[model samples]
Structures are given as C-alpha cells and as structure tokens.
Target: MVKLNKKYLKPLKNFYVIGLITFVIWMLFFDAHSWLLHNDLNKDIEALEDEKKYYKNEMKKDKKAIRELSTDEGVEKVARETYYMKKHDEEIYIIEYEDSLLKSKKDE
Candidate 1:
C-alpha cells in the first residue's frame, strides 16, 4: 500500500508541477473566457445569423410587394381592401367572420 501511494503521489510532490497543473485546470474551467463561454457565444452567433437571414428574406419580399404597389391598379386595389376606400357612389360592406372574431376574443 505504501509503495502504491508513493507512486501515485510522486508527481504531486513537485510544487512547480502541481501549480502548473492547477493553473491549467483553472484557465480551462474557471477563467472568464473559458471553453464553455466560447461555445455559448458560438451558439448565440448562429442564432443571430439565422435571424439575419430571415429578416433579409422578409425585406426582399416586402420590396417586391412595394414594387408591385407602385402601379395604379395595385395602389387602388390595396387602398380599397386595406383602408376600405370606395369609388364615388359605391358602397362597401365589410363582412367579419365568426371564427376570426372568436379567435380575437380568445387572444384577449
């Protein structure tokens, strides 16, 4: 048993070696900029990149819609539907569905 203990504890008896080992362990696991923090920062970067891609696609779609709305007919159609605009002597009826009303009620 004494021989086994001496063999296992021989390396730890050197103060310089023990201090180096402790410093390495502390830097790897307990330092501010450790491996774990790097991994979390990488995940955050990936999530932000995905969000940037999604917003870019949405911006492209919005630009296309805006280009379409530059025409006279598109403007008139959008105005009539979105803002309930009507021509002179024309009556517009807005029909609200029950399901939409129920969904909005549930949201509230």
Candidate 2:
C-alpha cells in the first residue's frame, strides 16, 4: 500500500491549479497559436534567411563579373574561352579529355 500525502494532493485538487495546468496544456498543444506551430514557423524563417544570404552572395559574384566584362580585355577573354571565338589568323585547338567531354556535354 502507498501512503499519499494531503499536502501534495491539496494543490492538485484546487480550482486555480487545475485551471492553470489546463491553460498551459491548451496553449502548448491545442491553441491556434501553439508552441508546435511557432516552432515550425521559426524553422521556415531560418531556411528563408539562409536562402537570402545565398542569393546575396550570388548577386555580388554577378556584379563582379559585370564589372570585369565592362573592359575590352575581359570581354575578349570570356568570348574566347566561353564562345571559342578567335581572330582570323588564330586557330584555337581545344583538347578535351573523356571526363571533360562528358561535363561539357552535360553543361550544354
């Protein structure tokens, strides 16, 4: 047989204690503004913040490329490498390995 103490059981039997416990349970699990919903919304905010940082970094890289392309030498270099452009007398010989050929085709 277990001995139950009246001191501990008194608070549990009180109306105020019961109402407080029910309120806490309702807010944590059943309310429209529940703890679980707030947690999920916080996770979504973190994911969007990460994406925003990634896009800002990509934008900086694009701005740097735009500045470089504003010069004739940079434009010529990109054209020769990316588009395989050449002067009338200049013949460009591009050697592609097996792996490089596969990657190039994948990019196209």
Top TM-score hit? 2
How high is each candidate's TM-score?
0.71, 0.79
Task: Give the number of the best model, judged by lDDT.
Answer: 2
Across 1-108, the per-residue lDDT of candidate 2 in tens digits comes to 134677678799999999999999999999999999999999999999999999999999999999989999999999999999999999999988999989989999
Stretches of candidate 2 exceeding 4 Å from the true structure: 5-10, 97-108
Cα deviation at 93, candidate 1, in Å, is 1.1
Write down the RMSD of all candidates, one decimal each: 2.9, 3.2
| Candidate 1 local Cα displacement, residue 87, angstroms | 0.7
How many clashes show up per model? Answer: 0, 0
Give the residue spans of candidate 1 off by over 4 A.
Answer: 1-7, 14-20, 29-33
